[model samples]
Target: MADDHGTSIERARQGRMTSEQIRRRMFDAALATTGTRGMTLGFPGLQMDDVIAAAGVSKSSVYRLWKSRDAFIGELLNEAAATFADQLSDDRALRTAIEIVASRPDLHATADGRRRLILELIRVVLEQNYYSTIDSAAWQSFLATSAALLADDGSESLRRVAETLRRGSDRFVEAMASFHEAMGRLLGFKLRDDFAGGFTLYAVLGSAIVEGLAVRHLSNPAVTDNFYLGPPTLTDEPTEWAPSAIGFLAIYDAFLVVDPDFDPRTIDAYLKELATATGADSVPPADA
Candidate 1:
């Protein structure tokens, strides 16, 4: 009896450890799934079976852990929110520094920090397509889940889920809005000025950047070739994407062009800083 009890405890401990690892891998796999596949196809096309395969976990284990695909994704978003907390703190520091620059307009004292912050954000923009795409899916899912509650066949359980999703969507949007506002401030103006009908220029521009990259990356070679009328290639390497970054900088340049007082050199300096840090401006050697 004593031996059996000891054996049971050991098994239980191993089971617990396995469960913990499964949960962690599932979270990571969810991120991977959403990052590559979701960027191209969007979340609506995301299937649970593919997620299980990508995660390398059994469907039984996944269901035991998250109960359903939506529940798994919800937890993934929660994990992302927790991660964003750290980024939020960084944004706060950058915002405070930028506001100081705005008041005093000192390029030398604050330029390094500003450039570093822009590099951080630009890295996120380039590498983490999931950040923007997931928010869009979450918002859509929130509304759909909420609307389902009004149906005659609605269940109380689903309503609860919808409420949770609603809260998640709200937090996600708030975080994104804060980031957008910070970027706008860095540009020395609001992205959604009265002339723009209250629609955020940053959001539109960000979406365009994401879509363009996704097309170049996730689409068939023929599709890209059709657009370019030849073979088209786009690099995923962070260090080799200066041209794309330059394209983004041009939008900021246009904004600065309109403002006679705001110096374009400030932005040019920041882009140079980013290019140096990313090695995006490096030229390949000839006769390699």
Candidate 2:
């Protein structure tokens, strides 16, 4: 009778679990396992057992949630973008996301790992040929939906929003590549070859630190020596203010004037300090 009661209790506990929580667990497991590098592989080394173990679910649960790996990855990526959009309006959320990417101490070593993750995700989405099984619309749909997050209205303004995010994410991605090239030139060596780290570290920190500090400079013109402040001083700039893409680009151009001997590294360090102040101090150096 006691044994029967324990079995019944276990069943009741399992029954009490919500589907959303269960799905979240599964999604998180997939993200962790696929990671940044694994994301790039043609077919990332994903395993049902591995995700199941990571998610703390039985094989049957995993199968029930996503019948196949392609379905699971597609769903997972779509869900992440959707969740990320939820934070789009909150100025703090975007800053926090970039900061979290930088604060890794091992930025140097894992740079490519991050890049591959990004490139792979984009590659599959951008090139339908990359994945034979997944629906191509899934990728485009995710992009469109996520882009709409920044706007007040929904897909009614999706075309405009999509264009903006695509342009921004592209410009942002290009700037990073140039940064890597510049570093390879500046350090008189390849950041990946000479520095202690890899590409993603360089990519994230190099681009972000500059952008972050540029925002600072735009706000507090006095905080700088080389760059021109836009209107308000950093002190006057609202911590809550959201800078537009052009606003950020102007600051980027300003940094060039501010430091005649400008290296993005200078901004990188300053942003690190600022991030610490903001209580988001997990940035890994681009060459870490």
- Model 2 Cα RMSD, 1 decimal: 18.6
* Residue 184, candidate 1: alpha-carbon lDDT: 44
lDDT of each: 0.45, 0.43
Q: Write the per-residue lDDT of candidate 1 for residues 100-202, one digit (tens) a residue.
A: 3333323323434444344444433533442333335332333334444455245444545545544654454455445555454444343323345232444
Task: Output the lDDT of residue 288, model 1.
Answer: 17
Q: Write the per-residue lDDT of candidate 2 for residues 1-288, one digit (tens) a residue.
A: 999998788667655667787788887776565333223322256676777777765666667777887667656645544443332221243244334335442332333433322222222221222121122232333334453355544433344445544554554455445543433332222432234445544444434543344345436735422322233311234222122222333322332222123343543564465466557644555555
RMSD of each: 11.7, 18.6
Clashes of each: 0, 24
| Candidate 2 segments exceeding 4 Å error | 1-11, 36-38, 41-43, 79-288
Best by lDDT: 1
lDDT of candidate 1 vs native?
0.45
Query: Which structure among the candidates has the greatest TM-score?
Result: 1
